[model samples]
Target: MKRIMIVDDSSTIRKLINYILRKKDYLITEAEDGLDALEKLIETKVDLVIADLNMPNMDGIELVKSLRNNFYHIDTPIIMLTTTRDENLKKSALEAGVNLFLNKPIQPNLLLYKVESLLEGEKNE
Candidate 1:
């Protein structure tokens, strides 16, 4: 089974994504912020990461940069979920190594589709 790490400050977002992916045979793990996500990642190998933009203790861009440096996860795909539509923020995240972006108040079907596609691509690689 494939595992996904969900990094978001909002409990609601974490729960919603966990719920959506559960039906698809994907293993779900969660963190409340980027710092917390790092600790979780140290203990588990996740196939992909679905992260959120704004969070306390570390925002998503910093998290992506951190993950990119860690040799074990250098190629892991990260899809950032954010409420911010600002182009600058998007550009920063892309530069920091975020693979995909999903705006918040996320649509469940779209989330599933993106997750499945990323997961499939990972398998191919």
Candidate 2:
């Protein structure tokens, strides 16, 4: 089973994502923020990460940068699932090494499709 990490300060959001992904039988890990995510990452390796752009301590962009700098997780797929509508933040996320940017209120099916696609792409490579 693929392990996925959901990084968001909101407990509701974390549980929502966990609930959605659980349908596919994915092992879920929840982190309150980027710092929490990074700390948990040290002890648990996840196949992919879904993070919120606005988070306390560290944001999604910073998390992407940190992950990119780490050799072990440099290639791990990262998806920024944010409520931000700012194009600048989206651009920054991409430049910082996020593989995909998704807006909040996302459809569950769409999220599943994207996750599967990214994982499949990784396997192909």
Candidate 3:
């Protein structure tokens, strides 16, 4: 089973994503923020990461940078799921190493599709 880490400060958002992805039988890991995600990632390796942009402790861009700098996670696919419409932030996120940038209130099917695509692509690599 593919493992996915969902990093969001909101419990409701985390649960919602878990509920949606659970249908696909993906193993889910939840983190309250980027810092928690990084700590957990040190012990648990995930196939992909879905993170919120504006999280306390460490935000999405910072997390992406840290992950990119880490040898273990340098090639991990990251999806920034944020509600922000700021082009500057999005650009920074992409530069920081996020593979994809998705807005909040995302469609379940779309999220599933992207996750599947990213995992499949990684497998091919």
Candidate 4:
């Protein structure tokens, strides 16, 4: 079974993604912020990470940077989810190593597609 982490400050977002991925038979872990997600990652190995950009005590970009330094997560795909339409933020995320982006008010099908595709690519590598 594949494990995934959903990192967001909003409980609703976390719950929604958890529900969506759970239905697809993916193991889910929820984190309220990037800091919390980093802590969780230390203990578990997740195939992918879905994170929100704007978060307290560490944003997604910083989290991605931190994860990239860790040998265990060096090649793990990170999908950043956000409502921000700022091109600068998107550029920063890309530079920081976010593999994909998903806008807020998420479309379930797109999320699943990205998740499956990233995981499949990981498997192939």
Which ranges of candidate 4 are over 4 A from the true structure? none
Error of 1 at 77 (Å): 0.9
lDDT of 1 by residue, 1-125 (tens): 99999999999889999999998989999999999999999899999999998899999999999999999888998999977665689899999999999987899999999999988898887
User: Which 10-residue window of candidate 2 scores lowest in summed lDDT?
Assistant: 82-91
TM-score between model 2 and native: 0.97
Q: Give RMSD to native, each candidate.
A: 0.9, 0.9, 0.8, 0.8
Q: Give residue 89's error in model 4 in angstroms.
A: 0.7
For 1-125, candidate 2 gives per-residue lDDT tens digits of 89999999999999898999999999999999999999999999899999999998998899999999999888999989877566788888999999988888877888999999999998999
Report the lDDT of model 2 for residue 2.
96
The list of candidate 3 runs beyond 4 A from truth reads none
Question: Backbone collision count in every prediction?
Answer: 0, 0, 0, 0
lDDT at 45 for candidate 2? 85
Task: Give per-residue CA lDDT, model 4, range 13-49, as digits (tens).
Answer: 9988998898899999899999999899878889999
Minimum summed lDDT over a 10-residue window in model 3 is located at 82-91
Pairs in clash, predicted candidate 4: none
